[model samples]
Target: MILPAPIPDRVDVVIFGGGVAGLWTRWRLEHAGYSTLLLESSSLGHGQTIASQGILHRGTKYAFGKDVSQASMELLMAQEVWSRAIKGVDGPDLRRVTVLSPTTVMWTSESFLSRFTGAVAAGVLKSDVKKLEGDARPAAFKSAPKAVNVWEIDEKVVDSSTLVRELARVVRGPMASLAPDAHTHWDLPGMLSWTDAAGRSHATHASAAVLCAGVGNESLITSLAGTTSVPGAAASHVSQRRPLHMVMMRGAPCDLFGHCIRELSDKPRLTVTSARDADSFVWYLGGSLAEDGVSRDESTQIDAAKLAVHECLPWVDVSRASWATLRVDRAEGRTATGKRPDTPIVSHIAAAGHTLAVWPTKLALAPAAAGRVFDLLETAGIRPTGVIDAGEPALSPAPLPWNEGGVRWR
Candidate 1:
């Protein structure tokens, strides 16, 4: 818990949420001379951001398709943006952020479609994939079957905890955590009134409002819809939640960051990223396994994970490894067909008095999402008129998902 800070009664913009998208937007706007105040009802990165695998995708994942997808293009641009920022060469300096892996591997099982995908991905991706053979392969893949092909894709992975910390460090305004009931009455045009945990009512008047609340965006959008005079404006601003039952294995045999590609599958069979968990290491599983595991119970998900590891990486031993499951929702902007969105979405509700709703469909797209916000603000003629002095941040970065407690490993 953070000590209370003096809340400013007014700002240029009032941002709702503390996830990566929210933090990034605050950083960008504040640096661009806009006065902003970020309000969070929970700890920073409490939802989708912290739960992410932290992969800065360089378009390799989308290369299996017939042509370059919108997601591929967005992520490709995002990788360069993130690389510059992390190297302190351009954008917001993030030199202190830790890059967990310089490149993640992609291995394919011996099959017609798998081999075809391997060839197509190598051709389509802007970033080159270096095929690792013989001794060049990591220990985890050394004993893999001869038919399995492993290529190192130039995708960077960062430590989510450090990323959040660095972003929060750069923001110029106060990031206060609001109470559960702090989804206060908005004074429509500019007023934002909410009560803190101390029962003190605070109000702020902003030139614009930004919603980056992830799943929490649903209610906020509904409220915005109620205020707007434009019919069907709410339809474009709605949120969707795609569930994922991710499997985690503690005491992983070896450090590995890669995706397992199978026959006729565009998505990875299992996307694993190793992270330091207390005194041990954890293999966090995602990809098709996670998407399909949504309907599975905890015990069944673990069983599926075990079987996946055995089939995907036969060399690795997880016989004694403890397993757990984390259920999370991938919050995104609602699409017409309810399918996954290919790019970051940024919508402006002009009728709702300078309100904008944003969803960075993937972690890699957060920068692009912020860029869109800038575009919207520019189009609306909103300028940085003054500065807001709200003191220091009033909330701390949330714990890593593995360390958040309540998981029962077996």
Candidate 2:
């Protein structure tokens, strides 16, 4: 058996949630000498982080047209930040983490509109895109028609599970699992209080409290502030959920990561990633197919995915493949148009320095979210007191997405 660690009476900062945003913020704060504690109601990376496709996007997805939006710029910055982290030369040492692919491939069937899109993308991406000649293409595309056009991009894919573990290891103090009744209160100046699972009351005079609970943020804030809306915003802070139904196939024909492009659509027809499962390989499908699969029943979705694979990748032999579906939601700050936000969102109760809430719009933007949180803490006059020792209350890590298995394979 296992035992819970003794809770500390006080700390400089109390962070709620243990997803990428929370973990990255805690790591940054701790390294900056803050006495910090991370509280999670469940395991780390229990939601968005683990469900991510692990793509270190470089704004290439937004390069479909001539004008790049603000979201594209954020992605560009995120790409550079993640590149440094993965290399371990600048930011956190992510060199020890598992990288599924150092680069991703983009390809399309030869057509006038498709060629135009590729040209526009190439012009926008510039040096980020490298055209692949006849023999330079991946072997998986060997069966592809001769009219296919392919290019390589500087995007990378990392194992999200390993990424979270690495961040958790860098934290100074142990993370704790919050009790169901662990109500947080911060209306009073310079005070934070909550109850533990054993019905024990605990209060801390923390400099700041950060909520990085993603979809759980709304309820958490409402419980503490008596409202879900943050003060001084155009409107109440609301969250939107974008759902995805991803398809997975075991016994993949080969290892591959690439996007299948078509003439009319800006988004890819399919995005595929390969991962090792025991001795065999598994192919995970996402992008447009996953988005559309949300409305489809399991059998219909699997059939659609299989048809997509057959059409886009003639080389993939799925005759003996076992299929599964994983449905998840992408939570983010609500927009006026109810579309996805282009950047991370950080908001606090107006003039109330004691608490703040954050949503990393994309997994690639976690570092950027940390920077914003640091800024908020600074604006609130919150500063790191000192380093906390490693031996404090410890929380168990979140299980890997596949290990937790909500997937129903057919």
| Top candidate (TM-score) | 1
lDDT of 2 by residue, 171-206 (tens): 557566777657777753466777665567767677
lDDT over C-alpha atoms for residue 53 of model 1:
93
Candidate 2 local Cα displacement, residue 169, angstroms: 0.8
lDDT of 1: 0.82
lDDT of 1 by residue, 97-178 (tens): 8898999999876676787777666665535688889988877887787777889988999888889888887766876767
Candidate 2 Cα RMSD (Å): 2.8
Q: Model 1, stretches more than 4 Å misplaced? A: 110-113, 226-230, 233-237, 389-392
Q: What TM-score goes with each of the models?
A: 0.94, 0.91
The list of candidate 2 runs beyond 4 A from truth reads: 1-5, 65-67, 110-112, 180-182, 188-190, 195-201, 225-236, 351-353
Shift in Å, residue 145, candidate 2: 1.9
* lDDT, each prediction: 0.82, 0.78
Looking at model 2, residue 128 earns an lDDT score of: 83
